[model samples]
Target: MSRRKVGLWYRLAAALTRPPMMMLFRRDWRGRHHIPATGGFMVVVNHNSSLDPVAYGHYQYSTGRVPRFLAKSSLFTNGAVGAMLRRTGQIPVPRGTKDVRDALKAAVSAVNGGEGVVFYPEGTLTRDPDLWPMAGRTGAARVALRTRCPVIPVAQWGAHRVLPPYQKKPRIFPRTTHQVLAGPALDLSSYYGRAVTPALLGEVTDVFMGAITDLLAEIRGEPAPAIRQRTGREHPHGLPSVSGRS
Candidate 1:
C-alpha cells in the first residue's frame, strides 16, 4: 500500500508528539490491514480517554495513513494552534449549534477527497461507569451513508489510565499500553441509496457502534452489555450535548 501524502504541519506535529508518546506508553496494536491501503474512508472509534486520539493516530500513522480528526471548535480558537490544525487537516466541530452541518459536510468532503477521517462515534468520553462505549450519535452514519464510503471500526483501551475522562493531569509514572484493534470496513452497501430518515439513521448508528463495541470486547476479552448507556442529546456530528462535556 502506498503511503498517503503527509503535509508539513502533520509531519512537524508527529515529530514533536510521537517521541513523548512512545516514551510514555507501550503499544499493543493489531488489525492494521483492515485500514484501506488506498482511498477515502471513515474510521469510527470508541472514545474512552482524552489521550486516545494520539494513541489511535499513532496506530493509523504506523499504517502510513494520515487521519483527519473531528475536534472541538475551542481547540481551534487559538491563532497559531488553529492555523496548525487547519493545515494538519483537523476538522473543527461546534457542538450544539446549527454550524455542526459544516463539520459533517467537511468530513464527507474529506472522505470523498481520498483522505481518512476519524470520528469518535460516542462524541465524548464514555459516560458508562465501566468505560464501555455509550450510545452513538448519527453524525458518522450520516456521512458514511451519504458518501457510500468504507467505514472502518476501531476500538482502543488503556489510554484512559494515563488520562482519565475529564481529568486535568495525567498519571504517567508507570508506562501504560494503548491497546487498539481495527476491524474490517463495515458492510453498509445494502443501505446505499436508501432514504435518510431518523429510524434509518438510528439503525445505521447501531450497526457502526456495534462493530466498535465488539472490537473493544475483543480487546478487553469480555462481553459487552447488550444495552449501551445513553449519555445525552446528539448532534448531526455525533457530539454529546454541550451543556457539560466537550
Candidate 2:
C-alpha cells in the first residue's frame, strides 16, 4: 500500500493546471481523509460541468494521490493536449463503442498496480434538468468488483455556475466555489466473489450512484428527489434526456 511515485509528466501537468483552477474557483473540499492514504482505489464522481474534472483533479492531487482519469477518446486525439494526457497516464475511453474491453482491462490493471483511477460513472454530464445525478453506466462497478479496491464516492457541485454543461463560454470574472465532498469507501463485500453479470453490474452501479447522490444532497442542504433520472429517457417534468458519448 505504498504510494505510487509521481511521474514528471504528472508533476508538469499539475503545475500547469493548478494555478488556473485556483484562480477561477474557490474550493470547499471535504473528506480528504476518506481517500485511501496508501493503496489503489477508485474515486467515483458525479459530472455536471466540464470544469469539474479540473476541480476534482486539483482536490485529489492536493492530497498527494494522483488520479488517472478515464477521459473521452476524442480528447486523446488532440495534438498538444493529447500528448500531455498520454504522458500523464490518463486513460482514453472510446465513448459509445461496444469495444471497451481494452479500456476496462487497463483500468483493472492500473488499480491492481496501486494507482488511483477516477471514474465519472454516469459516463457524461447528468441530463437531469434539476442537475441531480443521473443513473450511471457500469464501468466503475466492473473495475471496483474486479479489483475489489476501495471505491470512494465523491460529490461535487457549483462548477456549473462557472460553466454550464455543453456550453462553450465560461463566466469567469466572478469566481465560483467548487464544493466537493468525498464519502468513505463503499463496502461491496457482499458482491465480492459473486458472478459478474449485467444484473450484478447494474446493482453495484446503483449503490455507487446512490452514495454520490446522498453526498450531493448534503452539500446542497436539500433532500434528493425520490426518482433518479436515467440518460436517454424522459422524466415527469417533461424533461428530455440529453445523450453524451461519455
Candidate 3:
C-alpha cells in the first residue's frame, strides 16, 4: 500500500489542538527527528495526565507524521464519530475481549501498513501520586516484537500541570510548559530469537518504560527512580494475567 499521509481528521485536529497548545502552553519539544520520516514503527509513550494524549499526539504530529492510534472499540462504534475515526485510520479494540490477540493483531497490521502507531505501555493515566511511570503492561512490547518494528520511547511532562489526570477542566491562563522528549529506538536484538513468553515480554516492557522514564528524568532534571512502581496491571481493577506467565 502507498504510504498514508495526514488526512482531514488530522488537519482538523491540528487546527483545534495546535492553537490551544500554542496559546495556552509553552513547548519544550525535542528530538522529533527520532520520528522516522517514513516507514512503520511504534512510539511508546508514558501516560501521566489526561492531556498527555494531546501533548504526545502533538509531539508526533509536529514532526510531520500522522499517528494511527488504537482506540477503544466503543469510540468507533458511534455514528458520526465512528465514521470519522474509521476514515482517519484509527483502529478499535473491543475492551475486555476474550481474545486479546485481536487487538495486538490490529495494531501490528497498522504498523506493517507503513503507518506509525502509538502505545501507552501503562494503558492509562499514571496512578502514581508523583506521576512517575508505573509498571507497564505487555501490550507495547508485544506489538513491537510481533511487528518487528523499532520501538521509540517518548517521554512527556508538564501536561499534568496543565490538566491533571481526571481533572474536569484544564487550567488555561498561565501557560504551562509541556515538555516532550523522544529517545532512540530500543535495542531488542538480544531476545529476537527467544521464545515469546510473558517473562521475555515483561523484560522488554520494563526496558520500554525505563527508556521513557530516563528521558523524563532528563526533562525534569532529576534521577529516575531505580525501580518501577509495581502498580499491578495496566488497568486499575486488575493487572492483565499475561504479565507473569511463561
Candidate 4:
C-alpha cells in the first residue's frame, strides 16, 4: 500500500481507539496544541513504558500529525501484533546493531515527504525507578541535524503508572491521567549542511534530555534530577551504535 493510504488508515485507527483509550486513562492531556500542524518535524519523548508509543501516537494524531515511529525489530516479527504494526507504518530497527542507516533514511525521507516521526532518544524503556529520562542516544539528534527538522521535545508523565515496565497487565480499574508537554523546537540551524561533531552532538542531546527532564518534573510537581557530575562522554546502550558525525 502507499504511504498515504497507510497513514490514512492509521489515523482512522487512532481516531477510533483514542476515545476509549483516553476514557480509560481519563487523561488530562495538555499542550497538544503546541504540536506543529505542518512541516517535517521530529517528536522526541522519553520512553517509560511499552504503552508510551501508543499513547504518544494517539496524542500526535490528535494534534494533526500522523506519527511514524522507529520501533524495535522484535516487535515486527511474525505475529498478530506485528501484522498490525506493519500496516501502521512503524519502521523497525534491529536491536543492538550499529546499522540503522536504512531506518534513518526512511525517517529522513518521511519528514522530507512532509510527515512527522516520533522517536525516543533513550532507545529503551526507562530503567529509572522514578521513570525520569535517562541519558539519550544520538539518533534523534542525527535525524534532526540531517533533515533540519524541528525536534519538539515532549515530556510525558504518568504513563508508567498506567502500565509499568515488565508488568503483564495494565491498571484498567480506576482511570489514570497522563500529561504531555510539548516544548519549543530545538535550534539546529547552526549545524545545517555541516557535519555534527561529537561536542556539537553532545550539546544537542543534552539540550533535548534537559527539556524532557524539566517537563517530567513539572508534571510530577517535583524537581528534576541532578545532572551527573561525570566528564561529558558518550555511553553505550544495547541499541545500534553510531558515531556523532555519522
Winning candidate number (TM-score): 2
- Candidate 2 lDDT, tens digit per residue, 1-246? 456688899999989998999898898989999998887999999998988898899999999999899998899889999999899899999877865778989999989888899999988877787788999999999999999999999999878888788676988977878999999999999999999999999999999999999999999888888888886634456532233211
Using all chains and alpha carbons, the TM-scores for the candidates as numbered come to: 0.91, 0.93, 0.88, 0.85
Error of 2 at 237 (Å): 7.9
Residue 110 local lDDT, model 1: 86
Candidate 2 structure lDDT: 0.88
Summarize candidate 3's per-residue lDDT along 70-156 as a digit string, tens digits.
Answer: 777887878977776788777776767766678888888878988889888887777665677888989878887777888899998
lDDT of 1 by residue, 1-246 (tens): 223499788999889779988988898989999998889999999987788888888889888889899999998988887787888989999999999999999998888888899999888888776778888999999999999988999999888878886676988878888899999889998888888999899999999889999999999888988999886643334433323211
Model 4: pairs clashing at backbone N, Cα or C within 3 Å? 97-240
- By lDDT rank, best first, the candidates go 2, 1, 3, 4
lDDT of 2 at 73: 87
Q: Give lDDT per model, in order.
A: 0.86, 0.88, 0.79, 0.74
Stretches of model 4 off by over 4 angstroms after superposition: 1-8, 228-246
With a 3 Å backbone cut-off (N, CA, C), the pairs that clash in candidate 1 are none
Candidate 2 segments whose C-alpha is farther than 4 A from its true place: 233-246
What is the C-alpha lDDT profile of model 4 across 1-246, one tens digit per residue? 112333665766776678867776756677777677776788889887788788877778777677889998988986967877788888888866776878888888888877788889888776554556787888778888888877888987666666776565877766777778887887767767666888777877888888888878878788866962221233233221112111
> Which numbered prediction scores highest in lDDT against the true structure?
2
